[model samples]
Target: MTFIALTKPQMRGLLAKRLRFHIVGVFAVSLGIAAFCKFAVAKPRKKAYADFYRNDDSMKEFEEMKKAGIFQSAK
Candidate 1:
């Protein structure tokens, strides 16, 4: 087997040639992670918020706020 040595210019050219594919690979990976977060992480978080609000007692909260004097009655 023969070993071949690349000069700095040749190495730079090779890196430049491969840069597009590297950039595309990184972009694809970023898109995949975003998709996973949207579907897996965000969906569950959204559902949890929905469930919490669905079971929330607005009247009870209003009474609590009234007791706490958070609202001022306008004369």
Candidate 2:
């Protein structure tokens, strides 16, 4: 039946109207997630890295290793 199948023009028109909205919505959601990750998730990770590097014990170990000649000498 004609009602069961969409005509070519009907399909094309429907796609043309709806596809742009879907694309824009998807783009917006992706941008939001990226921004959230950058501001929310990345901040704590950066803080953790900074704390690890700045800890007294870590620095002491690093200096000890350097003094022990654990690292390769630069030519």
* Top candidate by TM-score: 1
Record all residue pairs in model 1 with backbone atoms less than 3 Å apart, i.e. clashing: none
Candidate number of the best lDDT: 1
TM-score against native, each model: 0.60, 0.57
Instruction: State the lDDT of candidate 1 residue by residue for 16-42, as single tens digits.
Output: 779988999999999999999999999
Tens-place lDDT digits, model 2, residues 1-75: 356775565644788789889999999999999999999999989998898777658667877888888878721
- TM-score, predicted candidate 1 vs. hidden true structure: 0.60
- The predictions' CA RMSDs to the true structure, in order, are 4.7, 5.4
Colliding residue pairs in candidate 2: none
In candidate 1, residue 27 scores what lDDT? 100
Which residues of candidate 2, in runs, are more than 4 Å off? 1-12, 59-75
